[model samples]
Target: MSHVTARVSEGERDRAVELVQQAYADGLLAPAELERRLERALTAVSAHELEPVVADLPDQVVHIASTGGRVTRTGDWHVPRRLRIDSEYGRVRLDLSRAHVPYSRIDIELRLAYGGGTIILPAGASANADGMRTEWGKVICKAPGRQSPGRLHVQVTGELPYGRLTIRRK
Candidate 1:
């Protein structure tokens, strides 16, 4: 019999170990398989796994600095992963595209004004915001989501009725 010490709470650890024993007694797992599964379960139940899950999530509605990670929403109309700012000849356009990020969860903030605009996102794979105004156009953005354990695609676009257009992502 080997002893395993995991940083999980006592009850959780005991429960996982019990499950392993049950698996073994049922002949569903070999000794080595039981040990491996126990270790994996203990890690899965550890508190440390919860920290980075929210580390890159934004806490407010306004963006200050860029977090430079990435965000993947499982749905649509999401806040963008990159803050986009465009200024030319006194006209500006802000595009917020947080769609198609790779992570399971994220938080971000963005605002567009002086013709600027902001988007509150839910989750999706892409985004676009464009409008026509007389004097000024604005574009605002939020921090990116974390790219820790997956791949994400982000595409941003800015176009004018008679001037220029840009497409970008990192």
Candidate 2:
């Protein structure tokens, strides 16, 4: 049998409904459309029924994981509402200076074992790294600790062991 005909668990149904709700919250779905999708998602029995509910919505979370080597994202890339980067041993360079960020606030969660992370924020932006914990490293924030009103705010969180996280603005 095809995946579309496979049975869907309750968790899958809940995820579909949540995706529709988030799409509405993100202004991608109208009230009537969201209601329609939610109803369909709640009633969905198989993967086929739920597949189209949020097929066009942007992903709520983007996760990048690596075992080693360099992991970088720069230039005009779409910055998601939430980002997760996990690496065992690699340098992470996320340059948001020339990126296309639609949201006012972006949350970045990083978990590194033995690699350093460098995040270059766009101008007129600030960051808060208070929630980050370093077991044997440091977290540096060159940008203002508190984000200003009407400006972009980057909230950094997660853990870094044996490596540092440097947040700066260009």
Candidate 3:
């Protein structure tokens, strides 16, 4: 039987472009290849079309959403280039001490509504919470310095409304 191809969403296209750009930035792709992949990703209409654009990229984008309850990611999980977390009346935790971070940088987007969470990273990793915002909530970022060469750099972005976000190094 012939498999049906799923249509590509705008987010997927954008993610593909981001991956291509990241690969180019990381020196994994040549300028011409980056241009070609970006053009393909931008004009992709189906998942099949977009797959090849990011197939050679080493990083991925993961999205986790919770309506209510607790969600946690720990242990030796593969850390994607971009991670988006959404919680509504739920608690979320990400422990990245043992995570496999292939890239030197990662971006995390958080959307917490009436919920709180904590992020535990390795001591060698450095965190940037400049893009994060809070309203009627508290965000405690205790990221230490002295980043090693080629260490992971995490950029935390997004909003927390009436919820707490704590980033600590272990």
Candidate 4:
């Protein structure tokens, strides 16, 4: 009998790397351990291979629900592995300039219905919005470049049915 293996995408690999970085940042992994995990994550070919890289780290999820009011996240806040934002007739702003982003990559899911939001990343951070969808609305992305070594990666996925989503570098 043959077992099929699921292939991992670039985004998955990037997220794995991010997890390793987060562990390192949190002092849970030594330099050698971090290096090893990073190497493994970058070379991982399947989802199963990425699991061990972050198995020892803590997992966190942030949820923001807005109703006709401004919701902002900024200043020394801890960046979670997953962030879910739901907005209706309001705005959301995420500023990562001085925030502590332990993960090298962060996944943000947004559901914008008649609302808008903005994501402000640090200088070396990169964002991928290919997985996001906008209908009857607009998404403006202004960044310096793509992800590279020693840079953070943000993967934006979700739907914007009737609002705007802006991602910029600060």
Candidate 5:
């Protein structure tokens, strides 16, 4: 989805600062990166847009995993494994393990929806198909130089459906 922009509130800004500070203290981000994200948060237009940018900060990080049975559901839900991270300049990984569907080709889908950012895959890592199947939905793992720090889009598709997506620091 496209990013939604608007004016940010005091509470939102405060939360942003708190998150950034925590990231810095944890040594997840460098001094410069912390300053950059702080500036963005201070002058953010809207909470919605700020959230993604802040979430993608250099120190802020994330890790998500999904397997068989119900993973993400509404109300009275229980996550066998769930982790949401935020750092200054870090890595976000998604480990997906899907069971095979016998003779039929299982369709494994991966989606990365954010306002704008870069999607870095594992080093020397290459997708089963092209770097990224644009028309098909999966995000193209653009070169680091071409990485957009805003509104990154990713989607992974698999037929065998037995693999995991992991995110970690170098």
Candidate 6:
């Protein structure tokens, strides 16, 4: 339980590389350090190696659960392959229109109660909320449902009792 030795996927490697490059571009890393970290990130075999490469960088958000608070993500944020959200109240807004989406397909699992959620996808990104279930709420997907070649597909699943989930394309 102390270490994770699982083999890294190309997606993971690419994400790390992007983070490193971003750090350099943001002037958080010097040229020599950027080159060093980029090389290590590209050759990383597991999450262990990736830890050091991005240890000083901004942490990515993949999971969020709140009892009662508003949740929002906009601008140039990084989108992981999968996202999990649990909220008891307040609104959850996620705008991926200008974010860094490195995956072709993204999965989102939501658990909300007595609140609403909105997700805005980038242009040409297709998404579907078919897998979701609601007891006293509604799910509206304004984007296309089917997966398209060379386009991003988002699959959303979960339960949002007494809340609404709105997914639309920008």
Best by TM-score: 4
lDDT of 5 by residue, 20-128 (tens): 7667876887999889888888888777758864675443222443332223322232222112322222223332222111211111233322211222333322323
Give the per-residue lDDT of model 1 (tens digit) for 22-126.
Answer: 557657777888676666656665546423322332323223322332221233344433334433223222333434433333222222122222334333323
Candidate 2 per-residue lDDT over residues 41-117, each given as its tens digit: 88888888789887887766799999998999998998987899999999999999999987777889999989999
Q: What is the model-wide C-alpha lDDT for candidate 6?
A: 0.85
Residue-pair clashes per candidate, as listed? 20, 0, 0, 2, 26, 0
User: Which has the higher lDDT value, candidate number 4 or candidate number 5?
Assistant: 4
Q: Among all windows of ten consecutive residues in candidate 2, which has the lowest summed lDDT?
A: 11-20
Q: What number of backbone clashes does candidate 4 have, counting pairs of residues 3 or more apart or in separate chains?
A: 2
Q: In terms of lDDT, which candidate is stronger, 1 or 6?
A: 6
Residue-pair clash count for candidate 3: 0
Q: lDDT at 103 for candidate 4?
A: 65
Give the least accurate 10-residue stretch of model 3, judged by summed lDDT.
144-153
lDDT of each: 0.38, 0.87, 0.85, 0.84, 0.40, 0.85
Query: Per-residue alpha-carbon lDDT of model 3 for 70-126, expressed as tens digits?
Result: 889899998888899989999989999988877776789999999998999886898
Evaluation by lDDT, superior candidate among 3 and 5: 3
Give RMSD (Å) of candidate 3 vs. truth.
9.1
Best by lDDT: 2
lDDT of 2 at 32: 100
lDDT by residue (tens digit), candidate 6, 52-119: 88888864548998889998899999888679899998888989999998767777888888888999
Off by over 4 Å in 5: 1-4, 56-170
Displacement of residue 76 (Cα, Å) in model 1 is 58
